[model samples]
Target chain A: MKYKVTESENISTVFLDGEIDMDVADNVREVVFPLIDSGKEVHLNLKGVQYMDSSGISVIVESNQRAKEKNTKVELKEVSQPVEKVLAMARKFL
Target chain B: MNTEATNLSEKKDFLVRSSSLKDVRSFSREVFEKFKIDENLREELVLAIAEAAQNIVKHAYKDYPDTQDRMAVRISCTDKELEIAFFDKGKPVEESKVKHRAIDDVKPGGLGTFFIQEIMDSIKFKEGDKPWINNLVLTKKL
Candidate 1:
């Protein structure tokens, strides 16, 4: 998986591409945590993401929670069919 | 690769083999489409199955570093519901402990199993010698 981080003004956008699975969870966490901790508004772009699993969902959810704590809002944008489905199902439980 | 022979002899098979989590979503979409599953239900079923399959890869086979020992996911559906099963040669999960976690938390990390249970109509886990099979059955009213 490949991720690129870009910041403009008060919003930080994380553009994710490729597959998000168990193998990439730790790497994703490492990249996302610092930016989130910096207390900037975050937006996750899933347009290029080809796949997603529970591990990936978990990472996103955790990031959302962290962002919430810092009063930073995290929004999901341009999600693919698969990632959108995962998020929808997750919303039922969370 | 003989194109003519391949086209003539090709059999339509729904089975998907995945070693990485990346393949799960795409495979789920293919299976859902083949079954003529509804658009709304297709979304839910894919997510539920993806999460279940990912858990099998992450926790069940954590000790096995080799890709050869990874889990296998099988999905089949009738007119009413989609059934997804995960087979792995790894440790069996404690059902009692898992059930407790389902109701306790709403956050992201520990709720994979719970989310699968709630999204799917029925969930069954079978544990035995050497290889353990975790099956998740999801039903969408069509």
Candidate 2:
């Protein structure tokens, strides 16, 4: 997956592209987690992401939980339809 | 999705590596398209299939990263249901050990199996006959 992190003031928006599976989960976490750890609110823009599997879903869940622990939040923004569907299904489990 | 179609079975083999996940998903999408699966459900099916494929790569073949093994995925659709089978020559899957973590537990890593269980109607793991070591079959009603 390809990603770009745009920082405006304190919020960091990570615009992720391509498909997210097991192969790219670590890379995704590497990109998104540190920003969350930075104590800044993070926004994961899924508009460019066309497909996401369980692994990708885990990244989001883990990020949110991490944010919770850090007293910050990782907000999902402009989630693509495909990702929204996956997230909806995953939410049933969460 | 009602009458069983006797005419739809397609299969493909890919290297048993994490990088092959996209190919696995692409193959699934193509087959689902030919089977005329609804566009909405097709992506869900693809996610299910890809998760199963990832299991084979991440769990079954976790020890053999450098080995040149190719796993096969077979998708068959009948009017009533769709069956997807995964064949891999890796560690034998212990049926009792194949459990997804409690969803409410909220964690990473184990969600792959959970997604598979959610998307498919039933899932079974069998001892692969001959050249294959593990056989995982997932079925979903159309």
Candidate 3:
């Protein structure tokens, strides 16, 4: 998967594309954690994500957790149906 | 055990093993098509199977470090419902300790089982066996 980060004042928008699976789980952790740990508002755009798996869901959930630790807000936008299902399922646990 | 009967029993035992996560979807699609399962139901079933299979590759055998034993996933579907079981000789998951950590709280793991249970009708885990098996069964009305 490919991810691009754009910073706008207080919010950081991360654009993600391609499939998010076990192979790319670490990449997500490396990219999103530091930003959340820095206490900046984060928005994840999943419009371009073609596919997702459980690992992908874990990454997003973990990112949200890190953001909470720093009092930063995180939101998800333009999530695809498949990606949405995974996210919705994750929401149930929350 | 008679020689003839043992050979017959061996032949009757069927196993379909796959290591590819992508195949999880493909396998689900094939089973749905072969059984004339509903289209909407097919998508749901695929999602459940994909999540379960991906969990095997991600958590069960995650400690390998070197992807040597990439993990194996086996699926069997019948007219009533679909059965998918993941076999990994990795560290056994402690059921009592296993809790669906809140997504909002965000820890790095623990969502796989929750997702599987959410999408599928039922889920069961067994680690008493030496190989450590996580078997999940999903059912949809015909």
Candidate 4:
């Protein structure tokens, strides 16, 4: 997966591209976690992401939990259709 | 490619590792497209198949990440039902212990099995005969 992060006053928006699976979940965490640790609201832009499995969903879940602990927030933006479908299924379990 | 073919079967094997999950999905999409499955359901089936394969790489072969084992995925379809089978030589799967984390328990790790259950109609685990240890079958009515 490829990512680009932009920072504004107190928020970091991470734009992720390519497929997010078990192979790339750690890389995603590496990119998104420290930003959350910085106590900034993080926006994960999923517009370029073509596919995401449970592993990807796990990253989002863990990030959200981490943000809550850090007194920040994580939001998903421009979620692609495929990812939206998977997220919908995951919402059932949440 | 016969889109109208009612009875179809395709099998492919990949080295058992997290990196091969993309290839698994590619093969699945090819088979589903050739079989003319609905576009709306194609991605869901792909997710279900990928999660099952991920389980093999994650749980069954947890300790053997660098091992040179291979797993096979077979997708077969008839006029009324679609069946996807996974054969892996990793550790044997314990059926009774394979439940997903409790619904109210919000966590990351156990959702793969939950997604499989949500997307597929049935899930069955069997002991493989030879050269394989775990056989997982997931089916959905068409």
Query: For each of the candidates, what fraction of the native contacts does it recover?
Result: 0.34, 0.66, 0.50, 0.64
Backbone clash pairs for candidate 2 read B3-B79, B4-B79, B5-B79
Give each model's whole-structure lDDT: 0.66, 0.87, 0.64, 0.91
Q: Could you give candidate 4's per-residue lDDT for residues A23-77 as a string of tens digits?
A: 9999999999999998999999999999999889889988999999999999999
lDDT of 4 by residue, B77-137 (tens): 9878999999999989999999888754544456999999999999999998798899999
Q: How big is the positional error of residue B52 in model 2, measured in Å on the Cα after superposition?
A: 0.5
Query: How well does candidate 1 score on lDDT at residue A14?
Result: 91
Worst 10 residues of 3 chain B by lDDT: B5-14
Residues B1-142, candidate 2, lDDT per residue (tens digit)?
4244455899999999989999999899888877888777888899889889888887898799877999999999877788999999999998888888776564445788888888889999999988999999999887
Candidates' DockQ values? Answer: 0.38, 0.67, 0.33, 0.66
By DockQ: ranked, best first: 2, 4, 1, 3
Instruction: Compute the DockQ of candidate 4.
Output: 0.66
* Ranking of models by lDDT: 4, 2, 1, 3
Model 1, position B27, has a per-residue lDDT of 70
After superposition, candidate 1 runs with Cα above 4 Å error:
A47-53, A64-85, B1-19, B100-109, B128-142
- Tens digits of per-residue lDDT for model 1 on B1-142? 1122111111121222234554666677776666656676665676677677656654665576554655656666554445566666665676665551453343333566756776787777676435545433344334
In candidate 4, which residue pairs get closer than 3 Å at backbone N, Cα or C atoms, i.e. clash? none
- A best-first ranking of the candidates according to their TM-score comes to 4, 2, 3, 1
The candidate with the higher TM-score, 3 or 4, is 4
> Worst lDDT window (10 residues) for model 1 chain B?
B1-10
lDDT of 2 by residue, A5-86 (tens): 9999989999999998888999999988899889999999999999988888888888989999999999999999999988
